[model samples]
Target: MDLLPSAHVDAYPREHLPPRDQWPVLSCDLPSLAYPDRLNCGAELLAGGAPDAPCLRMPGGEVWSYDDLRAAADRIAHVLVDDLGVVPGNRVLLRGPTTPWLVACWFAVMKAGAVAVTVLAAHRAQELATICGIAAVGHALCDIRSVDDLAKAEVPGLRIATYGGEASDDLLRSAAAKPDRFEAVATSADDVALIAFTSGTTGRPKGCMHFHRDVLAIADTFSAHVLRPRADDVFAGSPPLGFTFGLGGLVVFPLRAGASTLLLEQAGPEQLARAVAAHRVSVLFTAPTAYRSMLQLPGGHDLSSLRRCVSAGENLPAATWRAWHEATGLRIINGIGATEMLHIFISAADDAIRPGTTGVAVPGYEARVVDPLTITELPDGEPGLLAVRGPTGCRYLADDRQRDYVRDGWNLTGDTYVREPDGYFRYVARADDMIISAGYNIAGPEVEEALLRHPDVREAAVIGVPDESRGQVVRAFVVLRDGLPQDGRTGTAEALRAFVKEEIAGYKCPREIRFLPGLPRTPTGKLQRFRLRDLE
Candidate 1:
């Protein structure tokens, strides 16, 4: 087997990768996990599948066969190489909604042997700038709808190409001049394929580096063993392609099984149900909050075509699960996954599911509950930190916080959980200040920082408050500058919310703003988040 042509030795992704000693030990016991040393995941995922089979069903009733997707991806790969001067291992930042073109761009990056750095479509310029800077992204493919944010990011020397834009900016136009067939680069199994930057407890996000092998590993492990799909199945989901959860559910899992996926730009509760009905989708993946919201929708959405529904990104409340089951006669398959590990590590399908518990670890993965302080294994039924290790595990890119996440050999998923005697994992709470609201990870300090940017706010502290619909909502406690009108409470709160929305993603803005005389702090001056939760 011939090795892929090497990129510059000074590639930032390779240069900034964590030292060998810090990487979590990878394991693959499944027969499907046996992959070739010279593997191109894009070739495996896009080119070598059933080319004539239906692969992507667009929102407008247009269908694309596997061959169609492959041809587009190959052309895009050529565009990257010839038009954009992209070399193997160059970091290509992708910014767009989850559409067929975006999916095609992702596969194209993989086929070109470039590392894909995908950020959520909802991210503002500041977030985009921080991520691009951290990942050292030099080239970008962005949707025209999102090009404004990319331009606002002002990344240095970033070569920008547009897709879903005007004729002059369209990537497809560039690719039209190129051949529609391309041979994917044969890269080593351990080569970094993509960088998924997940939000941290602090204000910054940490990039989790995954390999070509890890790309196939998640599909072989969780998707293969747990959420098994047939070639006839059509998958659809809400999470953005930037999130690993969305990437796995929409792209990897379906494509791995030679199935098709329906890409939806907006997959809220009502829209999701409509998509299921309109597309006759067979497999559904979304967060728990979406399930709860859909359960409240007026009953005209035909969901009889859906055989499976997957819930993740946050805990599935037993009540919400039962409600969804009673409404649809389908038990939502609950799972727990992290950006670091790439996809779901624990999940149960159909009859094997227990209402409140995240079922046993998926085949090819191992998990345990450990004492948060000592890092020692804890007995079942005792709440402690959840540690997981498998073919995919934590690999932070040049972040010192890697030491806190990976201990010994286990990836401590900053989550508190209790394992039942039957091997079921029950979610307790988050071990850190990071808040999971409506399936998006919102750092409290990040919200506080946004709020503080407002002139009217003297001091601000943000925390997650329990909510039935959103799972949690961001609530801010603020000490306001003295001159504000007390009678204008409604106006003031809305003003602060709008102000924060300008600085950050609208989803992270405070849903409720309460002006307080002072925020609760410890004697040592540490913000007492627990105390704020009690007030809620």
Candidate 2:
């Protein structure tokens, strides 16, 4: 792959991108993915729609119109260049919840031709320092409430600016005095726009670099084709802006469609439900766990306004999908995506969705099940590694693991799946999450689905634990519905075990069941099975 003439003055992110030969095969076959050489995604997204139209909304009834958001972003971009001495391609770490101001900073970075490194507001000092160090971040734009931990990170020479505060030096306060009009940098379409770090479920977090065009590519392919957002639709979800899932669903998709989205700072299942009904959210994006949890709420929510529901971050169990449809009469669009790929590559909406299987590759992408070692395409119905290539694919920043993720021009997503005869891909388990117990190959998610079918089970996580006789045995951690009996631990465990045995093969049933208040999950609602394995 030949390099594009970079517009970056700093040149750090581009220099750190994986070697060209190590990059995954990137395809831009879709007509919509053809972007101009000098592109600024921040400016592109904001360029759509009438200036007076609503763009971002908050739970408190505060709405920022397209004009309002652009003015704020333009002023912030001026502050970054004039006051902070920032140049194009400087990595600016953004730490905050999902807020209009936080989003403004993201666009500000884009307009200034700087790279954005967005981390979860819940991250501690160590995690923050690791990310800053890995990306060689020099400046940070943080929310006042979450600035303390970032300050404690103690990255040397890391200049920090606080937003949403009363301080005179606050980002918003400084921006107020600056002119609300500035020219967006004419960056190359291939210019690095953001570095999204993985959730670190397996081990050390890897920074996945995405180009400016990649940001719009996801919206063009998945959101345009599958989600099919309308300008009148109000989008809302549980994921924060730090996660690509949220960034695409809440920010990129809606903006590309000239729609509005409600940004929630703390969106749990109950809160998400209330927000949806209160704000009349039509498009929803969240994980399967949240969908299942919302179903078990004591006083049911009025979700009649919902027109589309998307589930990702983890596999969607067939039982949960059926239950949601039965309760809401809406088919949940289930998909599988990776931080490396930036957003979903496989998904189907409306009548095209097949229960339990992740739909075919989105229009601009190609997917196949392949042998992990040899990279040979496997026959349909056989479980193998998932290989994908599309308008967006993995491009790790200065990491040796890039070779491990992209092999033979294909990105092996480290997920095990089976391609049905109809071409739909069914998730088996994560490559590392597969359990071999007593010579039987078992998938943890399969067991989890069977357990979720039980009436009392609110949430479940299955993992293989070491056992002297069987080499490894299935262990399940369950969270029961509220008001369920907690006194008879033995009786309840036995009954749940019996239920699972009835649902799945007796050999695949969990031999050990432990009840818990809740399962360990990332901020994005992905079950941290590695943490559960550590408990054993």
Superposed by TM-score, candidate 2 places the C-alpha of residue 523 at a distance from the truth, in angstroms, of 0.8
Off by over 4 Å in 1: 1-10, 433-536
What residue pairs are clashing in model 1? none
**Number of the top candidate by TM-score?**
2
lDDT of 2 by residue, 340-418 (tens): 9999999999999999899999989999999998999999999999999998999998889999999999999999999
lDDT of 1 at 63: 89
> What TM-score, over all chains together, does every model reach?
0.81, 0.99
Count of steric clashes across candidates, in order: 0, 0
Top-lDDT structure, candidate number: 2
lDDT of each: 0.83, 0.93
Residue 509, candidate 1: Cα error in Å is: 26
